[model samples]
Target: MCSFKKVSPITSTGSLLCTSWKQITSTEVPAVSVIANNSSCFQRLYAVLEALSGVEPGEDVLRLAHKVQALPNVSFKGIQCYNGWNQHIRKVTDRQAAIDLVVEKTRKALQILKDNAVECNYITGGGTGSYVFMDVDYSNNLDESGALVTDFSQSLYVLSTVQSVVPGNRAILNTGLKGISLDSGVPKIFGHRDLTFSNGGDEHGIVRPSGNLKVGDQVWLIPGHCDPTVNMHNWIVGVGDQVWLIPGHCDPTVNMHNWIVGVRGGIVECLWPITGRGPGV
Candidate 1:
């Protein structure tokens, strides 16, 4: 509850896109459109965090002075690193030493995230540089590694199966990503036994060398990438405690929808107003 130049924050898309404001009475501060709706808020946020890194608030005063008396035995979390206002990563001068520091810091940040597991989507704030240099800590969980996103391509498989699944043959599989899939995102095969779905040119899936297929068996084909795969489908479906319909691309797809949808217990529900049937918002 200390007074700085002024702002409180809020975000709906992500904490990344969030903004804060100080209390403003109508008589004291006029509501300004520019500050409320744009990127200026981001710059302001950087300034505040940067300043806080150097200045101890009231609660830290005793701890601060005690450390001052001890002369250099302490480090503060609120201290700034490098440039005050950037979301980019920097190369470390000494790799091993920097790695040591990062491991120490991330171990704690991870604890904070686990504690807030029920309250946040992500506890994110090291820039791109931080992501590469800073993420390393754990007790007993296998890391899934970073996620790789790609566009839809006519060639290649997100998941590939041996067209030759001969029983006595060696196990042939090329894995790009390994983990659980929410829906497992299997591409749809319109109507052929040999599912021939390409990047976007050929309609039916390319039938590889005969992998003996019995009637009604499923082959989960991964798209060359996600974006075009999303476009190829009538809709890209997400299922979870948190299911959602995200646009693959907003502008082109906005006019194409006749209705909007929501889900509850595996059922799709239309939630748009009746007037939504008419175009042009």
Candidate 2:
């Protein structure tokens, strides 16, 4: 694996004057090199230049690309051309227009690189907001049929137990602000369409119109946002005879736990320690 420390120079107009890239790894990991099957010591860097080029002058983009290409131990893989606004576009025409703009900008950037003799081999961009079921934020995105897209299944749920009940009106759950995140929106009850979830406090969740639910009944909640919610939990219970819990977000969520418990047929299969946990990891 290779890491680059970013150092940016800003212009008077708040545009990027240039970006400096420095490779911190002196020796390459043999495992990574073998997996890649590449003998070159140079690491590939995919620069997110679309946003910069869109905001900065064209000359600045060219200059930045040239500087990255000039780095000795780095290979400028290519540029990532994307618009974040496209992810939430509900109309097909509007989404197409956004994609067209991204294509135009990407072509312009590629032309500039080719003219300057900068070698660019690949281009990558776009996001999975339209393809995956992650949160309430993605629930509004429309497909070609003008209906909501449901390309992926939602497999993540927060298993919480009811601690208190108020008859037909409401029920209090064990999960609250600390158990789940509310930045995107309130979590939805997995099977109970009539029930709504709200933050009760640090240690409780409010379920309105609780219906037939009573104390000790388990509630499966679909998190509004999965990233921070996964960061709040230590264990991800897997499915089998035992309850299964999968992380909504993998990278940062794994950093919060000490071990990954793998199970098979309701039995403990293996244990992997998370060596890269805590700050700066």
Candidate 3:
């Protein structure tokens, strides 16, 4: 759900030197101590530092370790998004508001290092999502060409199957009679059902309808909405949290790259490629 909303078609080959900036600024959250693990953990610690800070990896692992060991001049900001909390605004309206909000937060983040009396490097986790929201993209004062800049945390999932036919006098889903409460409108997808039941009661959800469902055919149910029907529970009999990982995050987090699904020694599973994503059928 989150990933699809952010897919941009990168048509421009030239630099995305955005002239506009966000006017909004963020309230600072107290910083936490991000302890460095060890030299081996960051085998190329200097390399990662270079990537985040835009500084040369002038020293080898040993040299960098020694430098930090003797005189630690930098503090670590876990350049990952999940590592931070999402910024809250009524909602971003104008570009200047977005720019100011973003820049203020970035400067607040730099304050963490500034308070520590240490210089810093921002190891940002970049992806398609960052182009729109990251601090580097929103700050107005910074040169389009720069050495270092910062941004604050960013925020940013789904479920299930229900069939609904469309173009009715009032938009409604077939799940109406299938233990579904229309807290939101019926889904809009054409062929599949993205309905949510009180629970994942069974694999197939029988459509309860006002005699609107067609025979020998099906409607694809795309999730018209996401309600917190289930988040506190541990597992769903056999398949609990596994279902949540399928949809993905709302705004991509810099910290998270890939997910590690801890399936308890279970059944053989095949990951179906989402429609139109790849050549696989």
**lDDT string, candidate 2, 186-236, tens digits:** 766554455577779988777764565554445433332223223233221
Give the candidate order by descending lDDT: 2, 1, 3
Q: What is the C-alpha lDDT of each candidate?
A: 0.28, 0.51, 0.28
Return the lDDT, model 3, position 8: 31
Candidate 1 structure quality by residue, lDDT tens digits, 1-281: 01122243433334333332332233221122112343334433313321122222233333332333232212222222233122211222333355556555544544453453312222223333312111111111122332221221121112233222223222122221121111222232322224332221222112221256553444333323223234232321111111112222222332344443443343544455334433452
Which scores greater on lDDT, model 1 or model 3? 1
Point to the candidate with the largest lDDT.
2
The TM-score measured for candidate 1 stands at 0.20
Per-candidate TM-scores read 0.20, 0.56, 0.27
Two-way TM-score contest, 1 vs 2, winner: 2
Superposed Cα RMSD, model 1:
17.5
Deviation from truth (RMSD, Å), model 3: 19.5
Each prediction's number of clashing residue pairs: 12, 3, 30
Please give me the total number of clashing residue pairs in predicted model 2. Answer: 3
